[model samples]
Target: MVIESLWFLIVGALMILMAIGRKFVERLPMTGAMVYLVVGFLLGPACAGLLTIDLQCDVALLRTLTEAGLIVSLFAIGMYLRIDLSNPLWRLTLRLAGPAMLITIGALFVAAYWGLGLAAGPALLLASVLAPTDPVLANELRVEEAGDDEPLRFALSSEGGLNDGAASPMVYIALALCGVHTLGSSNPWTFALAIAWGLASAAIIGWALGTGIVVLVTKLRTHYDHALGLEGFLALGLVALAYGATLIVDGYAFIAVFIAGVALRRQEMKATGEKPPNEVLESVERGQREEAAKDPELAHAYIAENMMGFSVEMERFVELGLMVIVGSVVSAHWQELLHWSVIWPVLFLFFVARPLGSSLSLVGSSMDRHQRALSGWLGLRGVSAFYYLLFSLEKAGSATVANLLPVIVAAIVLSVFLHGSSATILLDRYLSKR
Candidate 1:
């Protein structure tokens, strides 16, 4: 009873600290990722005994929790993206997703061979696993105001959201070749089939949920009497539905969430006639026209004011989960620091593999030289990297790779601190100027 009570207290305290820390980090121009990471390290076994609660043997639980977090984070990312598919932005997303991912994988594979002396299979596996950026962290860097309307910013935001889902197949394939699991046969075609199935499952589930919500909401607005806050509840329900449905179908829930968001946004535009209300939707429009008022910033502020806060809460929950899970996982394996092999591979991943891949993938794209450079530099590893690492290790049945978990966790902590802290300042000086 005492132990259980202590556990509850610790969780409650961490929750309060996360809330305070999130608000504090936002005002300071540093990222919440950095603070959470530093906090994790401080609470880890190396310092205080906060996360000394051991769970290393609980691989199944770790994988399940991490998977759930990944799915939630992915869905939220998809829902938040409000870009139009018909625009040039979609093309740019493909360019970044395709070339950038390929480059990162290729470069890391080479690095593994020359730098780490790893076999081709493991090198490729690690490269593919670590290639994508975490949208959960990337969204924190987004312009806060609605209608900030910078094309480049939208492109980066959408790319970050979609790239991880796109990279899933490649990561799975790499793992299969490394003899990790028999999700599919070793043939290239079989691997492609697995990818197709994952994507198809997600797409079908997302479309069903998205379409169902929009139709239901339309009916509610047209025929039923509902409160103003019902829309927000419906939105949250949609997110939950998308998550649950995808899991049931054995699909990638992250992809489903994103697709669902895109679908809902499309429906919104359709319902609203793709324009801000001139008179019918807003009484303020009449007053504005009478006064000949034309303040774009104020218009944006009004829209943001009317938006729901549920998405923000979802983002916070995912961020907290990432930090705590990372803390617990790392603390459990604190003894691995003595291993040079683990350390070297992680270093190569951050400094060599990712940069080279990003550079190659981004070449000849619409993004300017500065944007490309900043994007490469800011491909900071976080929850997604850890998720893949944990997933692979759990399936690998070997303690050799299992020992590397702490190193990866430490790398994520370092990334959340170093890159997350520097993103805004560096962007202003380098990419923003260009």
Candidate 2:
């Protein structure tokens, strides 16, 4: 009961701060995620001792909420992506998403073996879990607005969206090899079947549900007299449905959410005559016109108009939840930081695995020197890595291995706060100039 009340208070405070200080918070280097982590640490058992969260006891609830947040985040990402998949940028995204991820994982595995001195199983597991970049955090960097349609920006956005799902398979494989039971039975065939079933189920459900939502929205526009507010509700409902369906099938909810997002975007485009919603298009046009309307003496309209504020809000909520959870989990395992077994592997993942994966992924791609360099440098580790790490650790239940969990979580918190905070400034100074 004390814990529940603390949870409520923490969440309430976070919401208030986010509402009142969003722009100010995001402007600071690593400010958004940093604030969340700080709050978590303060309220956590290690500091003020006002909150104690146990995922082992609260696993069912935590999983459900985290999965829901992830789905909603992915859906918003899909809704905002206005890129044409047939473009040259799409090819660049493939290179970045595919090879870069592989290289990072391979390098991390080697680092784990040599630098961390971990056995092959655990090393590979750590590398795979941390492989994907978090789009929600990455967007905090310098990038075009959702409707900008700039090839480079679109490539970055789409790569972030698609790569997380792509990395899911590697994570599952690593877990199986590491003897983690979260993916289902221990048999290799059972694991393979579970993956295949999960992927197929998510795709099928996402397509059917996404198509239906698009059709229903179209009919509402054609037949109704009242303003439906379809976009807001549709976005929320689609995420809920996608998450619910994946849970029903015991599949990876993150993969299901991403597939749902991709399907929803594709279906919405098909329904709207192969174009994005005119609302977003008109908003972009208005932004451009207003920009032109400004004189040297007149105040410039804040570029905030160009962004999807609603999506940004949802992402902030997810960030809050993730930070609190990280704090609770890490505080419980604070002793791990002193161990070489833990410290060395965590260092290798950040310094070795991620960089190697990103470089490999960009090879043979059409990106210029600056773009490739930025891509490699901007591989910010955030919520997704933390989420997978905790999930895998819970399944493993090895105190020796579990002791290493906090070190990785600490690394992610470090990356998200430091990397996310500095992204905009760095991008403006480097990539934008290029």
lDDT of 2 by residue, 291-380 (tens): 322321111111112223455567777877777767666666666656666666656655666656656666676766666666666676
Please give the TM-score that candidate 1 achieves against the real structure.
Answer: 0.82
| Candidate 1 residue lDDT tens string, 1-434 | 97678768866887787667766766566776665655665667777766664444666676677666665555555544454567765676677667777877777677666776766666666777677777677754553432233545665666666777777777666666667665465677876676778789988888788767665545443345222234446656776788788777657667787778667655544544445323323556545631222232222222222222456566667777667667655665656644676676667666776666666666676677777666667776777777777667766654435443555666676677767777777766754455
lDDT of 1: 0.63
Kindly report which residue stretches of model 2 are placed more than 4 angstroms away from their true locations once superposed: 1-14, 150-152, 180-201, 224-227, 246-253, 267-311, 332-335, 338-343, 399-401
TM-score of each: 0.82, 0.81
Compute the lDDT of residue 281 as modeled in candidate 2.
40
Residue 123 Cα positional deviation in candidate 2, in Å, after optimal superposition: 2.2
Q: Give every collision pair in model 1.
A: 78-258, 99-361, 100-361, 103-357, 104-357
Clashes within 3 Å, all models in order? 5, 9
Task: Write down the lDDT of every candidate, Cα atoms only.
Answer: 0.63, 0.63
Best by TM-score: 1
